[model samples]
Target: MELRNDPQSHYALNACIDKYYGSKGLPCLPYGGVQIRTSVIDGQIHEDVYEKVYFVARKYFIKYSIPIDTKNCFAMLSFAIGPNYVPMTWLVTEENESKFRVDNTTEAVVHNLAMLDEYLAGRLI
Candidate 1:
């Protein structure tokens, strides 16, 4: 399924995949935007084609020794704006969260990237 917001914030490190999303055909990532891109994950096939995304996240989990439900179809990436800044996280969806069981409130909240940009500007929450 499609990710919720900023999609290109993720780049699967040279992993063999995308039988599910066959070459986005973009020469490269676009400039200075939210980095939103799309990939597909379908359980109907009961196989994974997004292992790059999944495994990269797994790497972080292992490094931090954090517990993650690999069965869950999302990865939460935390980042910082600059030095002395608090972390902010963006949740990348490997599948539709509205379809899967989700934590922290049981459902996905629809949000627009542009609007979120306006909201988070400098406030940095």
Candidate 2:
């Protein structure tokens, strides 16, 4: 999968998620203005393969916050094996209008990109 580093291009992430999971009709929640959800069926059949869908989703949302606010949003992507396996959830929030709080590492990368974009945009304008 291609990693997007541009904040303005966050629409790509939504497209990717829609292409992959939208057809499945998975359950999702609204978190920080982003729709968060999980895949019901395992995309791949492999042991010890930890899926990081939530983190990835959160990253994209938080990373592209300059164009929007990531607060007042809640979403989760859970993994389960026939009622077994622990599910994971990722949530994001903004302490203030400018600062974001995320619970995943991938989201951190996104946040940095957002800050960079905002800073650069400010300088350019």
For model 2, what is the error of residue 40's alpha carbon versus the real structure, in angstroms, after optimal superposition? 38
lDDT of 2 by residue, 46-97 (tens): 2211122222333222212211112332222333335333222221223222
Q: How far out, in Å, is residue 47 in model 2?
A: 32
Scored by lDDT, the top model is: 2
Prediction 1 TM-score vs. true = 0.21
Local error of candidate 2 at residue 26 (angstroms):
2.1
* Candidate 1 residue 38 C-alpha distance from true site, Å: 25
Winning candidate number (TM-score)? 2
lDDT of model 1, residue 92 = 25
| lDDT of predicted model 1 | 0.24
Tell me how far candidate 1 lies from the true structure as C-alpha RMSD in angstroms: 14.2
Cα lDDT of model 1 by residue, 1-125, tens digit = 33222123122211112221134331222122222223345634232112111222112210000112235434322223333212123332334223322221111111222222333454323
Model 2 lowest lDDT segment of ten: 61-70
